[model samples]
Target: MRQIEYFVAVAETQSFGAAAQSLAVTQPSLSKQIQALEADLGVVLFERTSRRVSLTPQGRALLPDAQRVLRQARRFRNKARSLGFDTDIRLVAGVLPSIGAYFMPRMIERLRQEMPGLKLSFVEGSSSELARQLVQGELDFVLASETDRTDLARRDLFTETLWLCSTPEDPVMQSDAPATLSDLKGRTLLTLSPEFHLNAIVARLAAQAGATLSTEYRGASLDAIRQIAANGPEVGVLPSLYALGEAIRDPHFKVRRLLGYDAEHPVVFYTRTSSPLQALNARLADIIILEKQAIRAERAPQFQV
Candidate 1:
């Protein structure tokens, strides 16, 4: 393994000294490894001179094959690490409160059906909070919205649109047209907590539309926003996943669309970069996506347009 690494490093850098600098090894040590590799393969790999060193014809032919071998070795190492994770190891997952309330059940059910002995624990918080925990390694997986993070490996699980929910009796909602931001001017708009990504989006839109975001009251979960919207004149903004679920459960739920806005969030599973659990995480992400599709299908007649 070390020989292959040394060979690829030198071949890529084209300098034993530079490769040693990058690999944090002595040049003489790197040269010794290369010599051993050449002896094992029975090939004169490089031509050495006072001013320069270059690959021989045999070295040029072997470079690509050596690179391929390095890639295979890396993949083998990753596979072995992933397999090292015990099935009974308790996996800690973080989730946004709103998503977990409705979406987690199907995921947990499916995961358990596949691995009945899998020990699992769930921690619920705002998306930003969950992301912080994930980065700190306090959680194994997190179902959250996009954040300014590049350290984690992410798989998009669901993309959901924002909906303006209100009582049908609200005078503005009596119209046949989709609700526009203009329709919200001077009206009270309920929003999720400031920590939620939706809150910031709603705040920005409210400023543009001349609407007033109810800062004194931010709904902690989508259900809280839905509850207030059910009987109040104040419009609430929430993801379509929750609105669609409510609409299907109670067809009378007042779930309306934004006239020209595609304001949305991508719910993603974020785990450690190059996580060994990625193989398992992929299966979980797929199940969440299917759940999103199932909910959309359940009430497609009203919202699909």
Candidate 2:
């Protein structure tokens, strides 16, 4: 392994002196290691000349395999270190602000209880933004809506229905009957910014029902939309869990299921396909799913009405 490392260092730096400097070894020692490696492989690994040093055919063929070995070795070391009693496991995770509002407090509490040594950092963003960060390696995992992106591996967490929210003075709240999509026609529908999957879903619903989406009242988050809807006749679309958890208790808001409209968003936990944290990520996903199921179970009767 040491000889292979020396060979790789020489291949990368293309100079024994530079490779030795980088590896903190004497130049002659580095050269001896490489010579031993070439002898064992029975091939010349590099072609050396006064002007430059380049890989021989054998070395060119071996470079990719050597890099893969190095990567796997590093991963092994990291996994071992993570298991140490004093090592703190750090993870960066992302979640949709709307979903996080509903479930994160409980989920985070559970994580703290179960994995005391794990240090978690969270970032909230729209589904699209979260997916982009996951792909860019900025996030280890994200809870978001299912997307068409092939670069991410997704696990279905739960599906939540959409609700129509408005202040008591809104016309839709004048009667006990549930409001249908068509009832929203000619009324301003406020929604989160387009980067959100909920925004896209609401846009489609409005288009299908001939309702006008409020261009001037776009919100950056569900809270903003709910606050805006409180001041006027505008209706805001929100996920059922969020509505049940927060909006229902607010006297200024009326939350209702849309009649005849089966609008639901499937939430998913996703990580990069190449991620090394697959097992840990899966465990976290399971925690979120269990918490969501518990919440829904507790709120079932309220939502049924």
For model 2, residues 204-275, the per-residue Cα lDDT tens digits are 788878887777665457888888887777888878767777855664466877764547777898988887
User: What would the per-residue lDDT of candidate 1 be over residues 1-305, giving only the tens digit for each residue?
Assistant: 79988888887888889999999999999999999999999998989887677899999998898899989988877766655333555788898776777677766676677666566679888877888888888998898886788887888877777778788788766765567888888988887878788787787778878988886565576777788876786788877767666766886776777654446666888888857766677776776787678777766676752
Report how far off residue 184 is in candidate 1 (Å): 2.1
lDDT of each: 0.78, 0.79
Lowest summed lDDT over 10 consecutive residues: which window, candidate 2?
Answer: 79-88
> Which residue runs of candidate 2 sit more than 4 Å off their true CA positions?
1-87, 175-178, 248-252, 259-262
Which pairs clash inside model 2? Answer: none
Q: What is the Cα-based TM-score of model 1?
A: 0.65
Model 1 RMSD to the real structure?
Answer: 12.4
